[model samples]
Target: MTWITEFAPTTEGLNACIDCGLCLPTCPTYRLTGDESASPRGRIAAMRAVDRGLMPVDDRFAGVMDLCLQCLACETACPSLVPFGKLMEGARAEIAAHRPDTATIGKRVLFGRLVGFRPALVFLSWLLAIAQRLRLTDVLPSSAAKAAALRPVPIPVPSTAGHEWLPEGEQVGTVAFLSGCVMDQWYSDVHVAVIEVLRTAGYRVVAPPNQTCCGAMAAHEGAAYDAARMAERNVAAFAGHDLVFVDSAGCSAHMKDYDQWTEGGSDLAVRVVDATEFIAGLIAKGALPAAVETTEPIAIQDPCHLRHAQGIIEEPRAILRAAGLEPVEIDPTGMCCGAAGAYQLSHPDISDELGRMKASQIVATGLPRVASANPGCEMQLKTFLDDGVEVVHPVEVYWKAINTRPVRQAWRALKTVPRRN
Candidate 1:
């Protein structure tokens, strides 16, 4: 303990680990490798050593950190309640500042630019979607292939199509939506479903005229300057909204943490809210619009961020039940579907393995279909889904349940879907 004097992690709050190793079993990377070095505890140690100047941040160190899913399961498991998420972000930031290499350079380029701008991000997604449909991925190398496979078939952003604003029926509240980078292009259906549900619930939803990416990609990858700038821009863009809702867990986590990201900087930290937080608060207040019945038994996978990061374990399920679904629990404590950010692509073997296990767990529940609140879990579950299994976001299912009159059309949407169960 004496060795720790000056250069602790800039992410702050790393001393909470206490070397308890309580988080190892819960971490997917730790479970797969059976190496403590891959666990949160070991990573913290490496981070500590690097901070103390006893070790240089080298290729091996980056590899260890890279292997992490950043799922935040470890944070939930800790009794001392360390902020491992921030620590990891800081560790990455430190790495990014000093070790700009060929390996991470492309990511810094792609994700940095994607979250930093809206027009190019949307256009790139459209191209990727076209490429997917055209089978154009065949020409790509292994690295690019990995990126494409993890991505959903991209779709058109509704905003550029035109300002499809929600009805103005004496707004009960105002909400700004985070049409995230990948979520915008690949999982447009989920975003659309969220909007539909919000509008139906009687609130005027606004896609903030000046809003941009939520900066999650850059933040996680350690592009601090770029991520901070994105945050600052969002803080300015989202000035007057009553609440900000982000459906993607990755984005939700980042948005909620904007207060932390700009602890001493931005003044808009108080405005950020995860989509579920807003939706749940709406439901609790009885401001939400009433919906129809969905008697179908629905299985739910709580994304680690939705569950562990924001303490939003019950809102998605509550909305499901309130909307008339059976609300079956796939895992009461919730488990990762193994799609931790870029995990499914980076470590396909382990990602697939964890996803298969989760898929099996969902299937075993004997539920007709599964629902998750986050787009990543939905996509991950869909990738290995066997026959008789269907995946959806919670908002999609909830919206479909409104009214015994039976809506003329299904409310939910997805890209590259095979067929409905």
Candidate 2:
């Protein structure tokens, strides 16, 4: 079989790479392997080879493509402004169409079928939480154990569908929130904080019930048809809202490109805003109060989706500062933590190497806590970082800073913390 006629990547994006090698240092896979085939240019070269009918879309070709984290840092570094992310996604789509392997089939099942249903996802999360609590994951196979270990412990209850929170004071218009599938089930606390923070800033927040997964995981896995269907569903769900706020960086990034996936999605795409960006704007406008009391320093680990994909570098820091926290820069280069959606599960070895690199950088800063926006990054950091090191969403830290009483904070500080493992 050859490249899927309809799903093949556009030659324009494939030919945009000029072999400048600027993307090499920024690519996680290339940096780890020092292999030209792993570099962005090398991958594009392979894509071109296949596009020209010089190579076959076989296991070897799929292996090279699968190795990428899809972090899109190379896009930021490329002088030619190559759309590496889109091109890579297209290549993967072609592979998925022509290959149809067991793993590909499983990815389609999980991302396409399972993620869209909140009840099933929550039920599975509950079971996984129980398994983690019981330490049953340790007894599972190596790969299964690793996947289970990433599940959030003490999983918060899923956010209510179609829930709406009114502003604390004067009304300042309404906005919709994306309670993502995995995020709503596992990290619902962050959504609570997001709502509280938004309300505190005088914006009514609503979690649209009709919204489903942002389809980022599906898109990254080459399930374009499923991804497009999910995008179309979200476009219809979020229509009429002037602004749709998303707390998950990965979701925010994907939603911003809805036009690429489906018709009528561009309107929704333009309305999507990263929560940090919106909150930062509020802070700049003095919509929220200044810090009541200063907190400890936090190292900011920028998710690749947030940093490279969305080009939101300083907004998170702005939010952190308004909460009276000093945000430390672990790496200005914005190296990926290797949690590019499901990349950690698919490429655990490379993911671990990158996670360890990020953890070491954070540890070197000697900060007690790390502030990360994306759920995947937070989990990856928690897995590799020292058990004592607290990993939290920046908004969670901000919420605690403004809401927690001094006595309660002191009491909480004195309580013994349990080991995550």
Estimate the TM-score of every prediction.
Answer: 0.85, 0.92
- The models' CA-based lDDT, in order, is 0.71, 0.85
Q: List residue ranges in candidate 2 displaced over 4 A.
A: 138-156, 292-295, 404-421
Instruction: Flag regions of model 1 displaced more than 4 Å.
Output: 1-8, 135-157, 160-164, 263-267, 289-294, 403-421
Model 1, range 1-421, lDDT digits (tens) per residue? 2122122265347666799888888888888889989999999988877766777878787788888888888888899888888888777776776677875677677777765676776677677778777878756874355344444563444442224456434455667777666676677777777777677566667776666677777877777667777777777777766577778877777877787555432446566677777777777765564344556578888988888887888788778876777778767656677887666556788888888889888888987688787766776787667647777777777666653344422322111235578
Give the candidate number with the greatest TM-score.
Answer: 2
Question: What are the RMSD figures for all models against the true structure?
Answer: 6.9, 6.9
* Residue-level lDDT for 365 in candidate 1: 92
Q: Lowest-lDDT window of 10 residues in candidate 2?
A: 407-416
Clashes of each: 5, 0
